[model samples]
Target: MTAEQKGARLANLWDKTLAAGMSEPERLIYRSNLLGSDKRITNYGGGNTSAKVMEKDPLSGQAVEVMWVKGSGGDVGTIKRDGFATLYMGKLNALKSIYRGVEFEDEMVDYLPHCTFNLNPRAASIDTPLHAYVPKKHVDHMHPDAIIAIAASKNSKELTQEIFGGEIGWLPWKRPGYELGLWLEKFCLENPGARGVVLESHGLFTWGDTAEESYLTTIEIINAAIGWFEKKITGPVFGGDKYRPLPADERRKVAGALMPVIRGMISAAEAKVGHFDDSDAVLEFVSSNTLEPLAALGTSCPDHFLRTKIRPLVVDFDPTNPDVAGTIAGLDKAVADYREGYKAYYERCRHDISPAMRDPNAVVYLVPGVGMITFAKDKATARISGEFYVNAINVMRGSSSVSTYMGLPEQEAFDIEYWLLEEAKLQRMPKPKSLAGKVALITGGAGGIGRATAERFLREGACVVLADIDAGALEAASADFSKRYGSDQVRSALINVTSEEAVADGFANSATEFGGLDILVSNAGLASSASITETTLALWDKNIDILAKGYFLVSREAFRIFETQKIGGNIVFVASKNGLAASPNAAAYCTGKAAEIHLARCLALEGAEKGIRVNTVNPDAVLRGSKIWTGEWKEQRAAAYKMSTDDLEEHYRSRSMLKLSVFPEDIAEGIYFFASEQSAKSTGNILNVDAGNAQAFTR
Candidate 1:
């Protein structure tokens, strides 16, 4: 296309965005979408966009100018109008003059609400003032990797001017707040021709009288910086890839071996209790040879400083090192050193900020051969932090092409890390679900009850491993769950829970996959319905081995992992209501379930002091979608009961006091309670999810 034709087409597209009769907020949404839709421009919650629009004040009956800025915590990529907060521009700007004498915390936080024209629940982005201070009708702020590559480099200021000349303004690193906003406002006024300002070690900001102008200016400037960056490079960016990675299998083995050791140490120090996060991406990045220096130099930008911290804690990974005393002692010491180093870093600058020392634990842990692992209070944050680091690595590698990559000075990083407004973003967040950040293992996980339980735990934000003897079914279930709740959070393993070796290997491998295990749902079992006159020794043994012994084997392995980590875990057994009220022609099944229930009680008593909680969920008839209630087993049971399969199902459902059929999902809820903190003070408890089976209820 001709340049003039292309410009006309671009103008038409821009006009389409404003579509006739659209409200100002709608236009803002349209423009924000343009900025957020590109992950290359902004990731998850890494950027904010705003528009200055006039709206009628319901109480005052007068038109008022308001700043509609992106709110805290939601991803801009999918944000709605409600995702943006409205603050009176005049009021917000007025605070800048008087904000000088106020306590930095109060000035930064306490007065924010009074300036809100529509004081809604959502908090405005920390960059609200930066957007408001600009006299333009629209503003765009983003952490585009290309711009960050330039802004985070050692000679960012000089290079920035070199690339854009006087068209861009430069603001050295300042934590986002009223002060930085005021500084930006003054800079823009002084350099009215500048298209945007690059906040050093932060991100890019562009503005114009219209959304189209601001958005295009952001794209145009970043593109220019990237073009300049490409021209500067004369050689390989990653120091020529001198490092060779271990084979994928070997990498997994190494990661599996070292993750728990790292997790245990960090969990104890940072969380005080719970498992740390480990992922395949982290493994790949840490295993890369470039990780050490790139990470040591610190986060690529300041926005990331709050998420990934200044530097990742690097752990030495020697595959030849045996997994005995020396290895354990060395890893423990490495973690201790990382913690102490962080404390020293904090001590050097804590007096500059008012907030107490944030958790001194490393958010990112880099291991030489194995890979990197990141930790957070919850799985989402862990995953997000890991992603940011991965982006940082790529940006830093790219930055090396032009010049050596360097992050903000330690003091600047420290300021952003403990900045009260940044910390308050976390404080204002709603509480997470009970099982968030937890790891759960479900045996017979391909089966109905097991799959339901796995789904429940995953929905509550737990990393789940589905362990089943049926390899085909296990693969299918794993694929479905992984698709639903991220492959990073779901895993599947094949194991005969009745075999000690298989159980041990399964639990060990799962613990390696997720850093550690927090909850075990022993739901694997076999069902047999035979009278004493016809029951065979094999039938009785099969039921007992799987139902009773399977629970024992799996729970024992789980306890070993939990005990090693000392994180206090949970074990939930899916027992049958038959254990409570035995039915005719089910001797083997009843005996096995009865034994399992009692075993759970015994484990509850034994594991209490160790912080392990054991509980049982007794489910009656769960015929729908159950693998156990099919084929020859179904035929045999129907014949024994002298009723057709349909009749038997109806009979069970109607017999319940609630006259409703029980399902795997119903049993799953009861099991979830025991697995979550909801039952923190309860143990040895038996919950009957049999649709009001009074006979199965236990006090």
Candidate 2:
């Protein structure tokens, strides 16, 4: 490929035969998905596409013009037919009569429902008018980084003219609303030959006579920007990196160490999830000399800063010197200063109708040597926030290299951030689940009890990291949970709870992947049934190593993470009724269980002051779906009782005071009680789910 051809890397992905089969509205969906599939074209849920189509009116029995556009909060890339809102073209144009001016643009949002065609329940966004007034068969407005770099530059207007001549035009800065839509209409009328326009400090808008033309035009415009920057930007990007980035492993270690500390500070009001980014682009920007100054300008685009707060807090660790301890020590004051500064910004920009001040903590944190860390209400939002910041970094890289990079004016940013309409949108959101922002690490997580508990937590909106010794079970279990709960909410680690290093590494994985750990379920175990005289030293040691030492190793790691976060944590130990009741010929198993129960009591005493709670759940006769019972223990125990292995269940059921049998799910509920706030005030307590065994009474 030639240099110019190579520079234009974005391929026109439209399939002509496919478009030939789709209706106009279906074609709109097709075009929207094509444009949104690439982040370079638009960030997630950031852009809108529309198509004007002729449809048969159900009421009038005549062909009527209707505009189908992406609905509010819908991502174009994943949207289906139901995701677009249809509005009567006549009703939409009629809105122009009652439309006051820029000041009353927000009120126009109320009138959108009145223009609904065929009663599309999908609400229209504020950008509806922008597409409605374009006077074309198809229109697309996108936030591609390459185009936004020029649009966000100091001389964006001049750059547009120089790049595309009269075919594409440039418009001055105007906050998106009905007024901006009118401006677009006027621009189209005056410049009849124009194919598109660059909205200064905003994004690009392209139109065409067909859906294919409009989609292709959007791609070509973005590639033009990319190609121009490749040739025009000859200088070192981001003022050349001032400090070399740490090795990838070292960067991750620092991020893991810092995330829990930061999450603890910011998650006071509401639990927040964390996302870390040390991609090449992020590393380049965070380690650069101009990182501080450019970050101070914040972001030019509304979508960029909205998810990533108004500005990021630049961490004070110099990569060359590498003082992690010093950086952590100073974070207390650094966070306080950022919060105070944000409050001051709110106070200065508040209007009578403005919404109340939101969380003042920085959503984005720029650590020099490592990369970027973002925290939000949930994992998806947290991850998306990081992705948006990377887009901003790319835009800044280009604009700063060629022309002066600029951020949105503070007042405008404040206005948009605290806008009453935005506030209303937030209010419309549904209430969060019980464990919405909580993350858990379940040991022996591929086993029956652990799997049940993980599913329970996941159903309540918590992110789960399943750590198990069984490689095959872990993979299958992880894939199952990931399919049911989103992949973002589920992760797995191959961990031997008896190995201190493996246990610690599992906790580290939990911290970096989902911010930090909140709950630890120590469920890894193996049972041995043998008379004291018959039990070999190896059997005794194996029982103690896995059941007792394993629990200790995992809990120690949990305590370390919980202490670093300074956030209260939950540790639920799955012991056995054998801990209290004497079971014949299983001396080693009973001794190991007793040790596990006692450890819970000791840890509870030590953790009380730190708000960490340790509790024990004693389960017995959990015969169904149990890995331990499937082994020699079942035959050995049955042999000692003078019964077949099949009769062991009947023996246990008949021996119980309630004549009931226990299952893994029963133990799962007992553990859940301790993990949840339902048992918040009661710690160091034991809950028995052993079919009411009189011999196992804790009281």
User: Over the stretch 221-335, how does candidate 1's per-residue lDDT look in tens digits?
Assistant: 8667656655565554455443445566566565565666656666753332122333433444455557677778888576577678878877665544424345566877777
Instruction: Quote each prediction's TM-score.
Output: 0.84, 0.97
lDDT of 2 by residue, 358-426 (tens): 999999999997999999999999999999999899889888888899899999899889888888999
The model with the greatest lDDT is 2
Worst 10 residues of 1 by lDDT: 1-10
Error of 1 at 533 (Å): 6.3
Each model's Cα RMSD: 5.4, 2.1
lDDT of each: 0.77, 0.90
Error of 1 at 698 (Å): 9.2
